[model samples]
Target: MKPTLRAALTSPFVVFTVFMLGKIYLSWFVIFESAFSWLPLLTGLPTVWAAFAPIELFARKRKLMLYMIVNVVFTSVYFAAIMYYKYFGVIVTYHALQQVGQVTEVKGSVFSLLHPYFLFIYTDIVLFGLLLTFRRTFRSWAVRGMTLNRAAAGLIFPLALMVSIFCMWTNRDSINEIKQAQHMGILNYELYAIFAKRSEPLLDESEITAEAIMKAKGLAANPSPNYWRAAEGKNIVVLQLEAFQNFLLGLSVDGQEITPNMNSLMKQNFYFPHIFQMVSQGNTSDAEYMLNTSFYVPPYGAAAQDYGDRALPSLPKEFRGIGYEALTFHTNDVVFWNREELYKALGFTRYYDKSFYGDADTVAFGASDEVLYDKTVTEMARLQGEGKRFYANIISMSGHHPFNLPDRKKKIELPDRFDDTLVGDYLTAQQYADYAIGQFIDKLKETGLWDQTVLFIYGDHMGLPIYSLSSKEHALMKDMLGRDYSYPDMLNIPLIIAGGGVTSPQVFPQIGGHVDFMPTIANLAGISLADHLHFGQDLLNTQHNLLPERYYLPSGSLINDTTIYVPGRGYADGVTYALPTGDGAMPSEDEYKRALELLHMSDSYVNQLPKHD
Candidate 1:
């Protein structure tokens, strides 16, 4: 072979090999401990190969620089948008810097563009872009390198084919196993490609149907004594409080209270101290999906966006069928997640958003909690006076990110010991929300609808990180939680169910998720849920045990419930707390296997949900 030709052929391959090794290294370092296997490497080969192809064409410094610049710009922007939406609940802006504490040079705005996370994301994008740009390079190398002899070509082709086939067959089970374990939507396309190549049959509809039916039967067999049976034709009001944390109950100023109304209301309500939300996606829309549909969000994308065009089962549809007029109110932009479309898909009769209210109603994102609550009550009364039972969803926005309010905002006094700028502001916002709820309840009572209404309230998710309370103010939270105070506290929120004239208050100890709310409410309202094989069980019924310690990430599943953190491959049980069998220990082989099965089942069921037509 000519030297130039040889170098041309080998250069791209070498770069490609280096890239793959990097991926393997990173995967091992980060994901491997979580039970991830080699499947990600194998499935990512096409993109990896494509990324290196560019090295042959744009091998020159000028071209490479241009390519790198373009790649970096796009990747940085894309990831920044994603991070902003995911963590901060808004678009990226100059003002975001003010929200984070300890902004050193490394954490500076310009530095954030080149942050490690952004580098990882950009690497993948650039790698894939190269692979796509260099298809001709591969074809040229393959043709020039192969022998002209027909017999030689025949022998080499079949040998290559046979080896490829053998490897695929050997790895088929492992690949399927990994795909089944992944819960993140971002990786689904690659996983689907692998399954398609192997010609593995997708999950069967009948299996899902059977699982749903069995779950329904089990639920019917064990009903909660506290379950509120449908009052033939009563109004139902659901208040989904955005970022309402249970810790707010402990918040105070100057030995006074922040959430006095919420604290008082809790005394009259059935509160679930350990109720967990099985949110499919980590956004507001995901919470809505779990609450309304009682179905897991497909791990790969936004359920609301994906199912916006498809028909799906919803709580409002059931309520409407039973003589209730259904409405949804969001004190924010209706178009935020295509929520207007989603509400229609969920069978809501009327949808109200910021556009429906006055300009003075505006809060941080949209309407103030006071304005939203008052408007909702007014609307409910109008509907009630029309001789119609109502099914209304009131989604609050005041307690959302930036946690800011007008300076004149009602201040809830807090103890001197609990004084901190951000935490104090956050507590004040919670107090404001609690005040709104109290006012709404009072309006219900005044209208004589308190006894005839069923009220359900829960947090959308955890409070956004309070930069002021970082390691300095919340040192104890970090010490006791074993995690940064930011992460775990963000996941803990309050869930309270009251009204329908229940005289006694009780606390539910079982861990339940938002998805469980739908079926539980449906059961109370005498509506049969369409899909019973959901990850969420009826929280009202405490017969089932708590959910295993599992965190479903966009990439894969983390089963941290057992003392060890078992990902997909092995156990890290000894790293944290030991398992019961104890050796200061690792998860038993059986425990790892069971965790794998549960993750697989969750993935399979979610992937196989009937796509809206």
Candidate 2:
């Protein structure tokens, strides 16, 4: 019955702004987990106005419809950002539109990320839809407008536009994308990204040589590189385990081993305990690209989507040049994540996907890891019988995310506390993956393929992202790891290189990334990368590395020998976290500069590569 309050609340301007502001608050809480602050509102208002102010400026009628459309659009953006951040720990941009198909394929993973509160973002739309059924109520609520005068519209339009542009321009150089979005507002940041030019010019093709890459990485030529040509002439086998992490190595659940086979392999081979996953939007495909090409993924999108057309210089290509048959095997369809084109670009002699694996024993995307290894081993045996020198890239799938393995595949027994949780599911799935790897290794041995093969096994990316963990799951992880699981632990993945004369049973503590795989393998296989322009150094030879990370972590993030430096705005305000070694030594500005330079060099070189026919 309060007429003045009801009238003010019914004003169209106040109604729309309130809805937007509430959505902004939810988005901020989900993304930043910060207490109430005026920054988002201050930065977000102008951008929000730019979207809706036009309706007031131009259209007199159908204003409600336009506002509704804009509201829906903004709400979707905020909701998407929230969902994406929960798993990825990064603000999603429009570049994510390219991943719409990929997202649909992983609906289980997407749905698992959804919270009931997240769905509340659409409550207003639902109410509005219900009101639409009653024309009188809809008109009374939506059309009861406090219309802005032409003079006010003229003033607000330019001022809001200028403010949005200013926000974008001022915050453009903030290398940390999350901080940039925070400072400039998420909506404005998305707009800025769409139109933003590359901050630095591309280097000339001649300037992007291997030597230049080495220099930028602070690594010089190694005259007598360690483990050089140790596996010269051996069959190359690369097994990319899906969503596996380093913490799983030797990890136990109440006296039972989690990855026994991998632990055994690590004990008898060259194991890298400090390699971090550097995948971007492409996830597994990004890891594949980085491992084979020694290149960073694209800045904003998946490598397979953005650079799959290029005939990339890769480990497979290098091996094929030396009279080896290079092939890749994945359980999923080749079209998923555009890996068909990606495999071709990497210069594989042949690739076997879902068609080869068949739909039988399917888990997440395709055939289970057991089936993948079983069939792949049979094929490898055939190749061996034919006396073919081969380079095989086998991608395991059973351990993919949403980690809910079928009961038949669940080999690990979870305690009551670990029941029905992501961490528990992840462990069981990875345990199954380990069992599959064990089977594959045995088959390799039985067929005499193990002794002759230069086997490289590594986790594709992280599985239990810290952002995806519930509080109980977080506590569980802390219990498992003996400490709070941090970014370094999240990004860390195991890299095991067995056979191929790498029987040293040594664990390399030197920091490395997926990008280091190619050079490291090339060295062991007697293949020279002197002519190859790669961003990563060989982990076997290099004692120090500055591994620049993307996607899951923020921009301007890098892993050095002693710490992971994550920038707040830029390096000045960045925080340093200890690696597993317990040294949180701050990275230098030079290292940070070189890390960025290395990324740029990779981008420039890859961008100039000849497109595949």
| TM-score of every prediction relative to native | 0.66, 0.97
Which is the leading candidate under TM-score?
Answer: 2
Candidate 1 residues lying further than 4 Å off, grouped into runs, are 1-61, 64-201, 210-220, 223-232, 413-424, 465-469, 476-489, 528-535, 546-613
Question: Alpha carbon lDDT of residue 343, candidate 1?
Answer: 82
- Model 2 poorest 10 in a row by lDDT: 139-148
Q: State the number of backbone clashes in model 2.
A: 0
RMSD in Å for all candidates: 9.6, 1.7
Q: How far is candidate 1 from the true structure (C-alpha RMSD, Å)?
A: 9.6
Query: Which residue window of length 10 is worst by lDDT in model 1?
Result: 181-190
* Cα lDDT, model 2, residue 542: 87
Candidate 2 C-alpha lDDT tens digits along 1-613 = 5876677677666688888999999999878889999998889888888776777778777788888899999999899889999888888888899998897789999998888989999998988877887666575554565665667777888888999999999999898999998999989988888898445788888887777777777778889998888999899899999999999998998998999999999898888899999999999999999989888988888999999999888888898899999999998999999999998899999999999999998899999888999999899889989989999999998988899899999888989899979999999999999999999999999999988998999999999888888899999999988999988888899988888687578878888998889888888888887777778788899888888887777878888888988988888899999987658888889889888888888888888889998
